[model samples]
Target: MRPSLTPVPLGVEPMTRSILFEGLFVHGLPRNEAFEAELRQAGFDRGDLLPQYPLRLFRQCMDIACRHFYPGLPVEEGRRKLGHHFVQGFTRTVLGGAVAVGMPLIGPVRFLKKFPEHLRFDTSPILVQAVEVGERSFRMEFRTGVGLSPHFLRGMLEEGLRMTRVNPTLRVVRHSPISFDLHITW
Candidate 1:
């Protein structure tokens, strides 16, 4: 993920103890491992959350855990706990938006309100911006540096889809001029 927030000035490390990274920032992400364990114990059915879960949904789940117990986790702590998972999930949402150009809820940002973990305008490498697109679709055009591998990207996508009701036809576009896409299909 591309890091948007520059590290704080010298001796500001303490302020960023919670940053997490998937492929980018790898700094203070959020976490709720204890809550996850409880979820398994409580037999939280995560019915369709098979191999993976959506990043946004994951955020929702994480928030639930935090509210229920891990209140100590601040913004950075939450980001660290979420780490790459959070970034990866949001990345999918970013890419999904471009492809959803024809769909109203394509970006589905409203959905994120309930699932409050994904960062807004993160500098993480997973998402980047170009002037033409402005911040409209940064990751959609970003492809200069190393991009995520298909194998890993697919997994992240699958996980993201599971978290929400993704339109299956929204193919995972990889290895194109742009790295990713959330296109429409019949």
Candidate 2:
């Protein structure tokens, strides 16, 4: 059966919307009338920052944007590419500067452990945990109540590690309806 497209009332922070549009722009997605229409259909206003938009709205807009930019692209690949763009765009923000200063000293594993402190998940139900498994390896697990795509998370983690100048190897050790595990090594 096709998944329902009913909007879920998840209050995402304004930065999340900013980062998403910035990422789409960086990837050359047209921010034209059709894009605005998608956003509207997803229940967002074009002129206002979506500080409390539904999670489904974000997901629908992202999916539409991806398809518009790259017709016939695989969903997973589109998600990965979008995620990569997200990290690149996000790192230019003020928070990224703070993250950069500590990445070299704390490393990706520990950096991830502290990542949750930066998020404002007042409406979403996503939780992240990082556990060290070896000297240079860690397992980062995400327990998501919302149906976030794993490929997107993988790309974000991969790019995050790369930003730290760490050549990372990532593997999906587990995936279920509610949780996913990523084994990361540098």
Candidate 3:
């Protein structure tokens, strides 16, 4: 099913750091002038990125990445691909360098266990609840004002797990305008 992209309540806005954009463009799609130009049109100039930005701008950039790199895929699939790129790029950034070095050493289970803590690196207002369901598996629930689609989170989690050298399977059991539940196993 397609995840909802409902807007957050009025007067409430979610925010993130510029490192995310840098992750996607500089680390994810490095040296792609076309992608850079597209972002420049969308009011995000990679040359002069902000330290923090609202979720709306982040969504716009994600849209651009989806269109630029995965146009042939379905919308959900495209966002998933973008999510993978986000993590891949994010880990390459100075902010995420620690994750790159540490995730593999700790492995997937530990990573998922510490996922909520890792998310603290972002300034976005989000609440995460993680529960271990079985060996090598866990369920994570997220509540956020940011309207991020489930596919993106799924892809991001999947990629993060893969970085630890384990093949992962993820599914969204429930989704709402403000919250979602993701189950993952490797």
Worst 10 residues of 1 by lDDT: 13-22
Give per-residue CA lDDT, model 1, range 1-186, as digits (tens).
544524324532221112212222211123446555554454332322343223333334445554544367664344333433543534435443453343344343333222223322232224423222222221222232222333333333334433445542223456663265433221
Task: Between candidates 2 and 3, name the one with more favorable lDDT.
Answer: 3
Which candidate gets the maximum lDDT versus the true structure?
A: 3
lDDT of 1 at 136: 22
How far in Å is the alpha carbon of 185 misplaced in model 2? Answer: 1.7
Give the least accurate 10-residue stretch of model 3, judged by summed lDDT.
1-10
User: Pick by TM-score: which candidate is best?
Assistant: 3
**lDDT tens digits by residue: candidate 2, 19-120:** 454444433243577767766667665566544455566677668767776567898778776777677766665766566566678767667677655543
Residue runs of model 2 more than 4 Å from their true location after superposition: 1-33, 45-47, 97-102
State which candidate, 1 or 2, has the greater lDDT: 2
* Regions of model 3 farther than 4 Å from truth: 1-12, 121-123
How high is the lDDT of residue 106 in model 1? 35
Q: Relative to the unseen true structure, what is the C-alpha lDDT of residue 61 in candidate 2, on a scale of 0 to 100? A: 69
- What's the CA error at residue 147 for candidate 1, in Å? 3.0
Candidate 2, which ten residues in sequence have the lowest lDDT sum?
A: 1-10
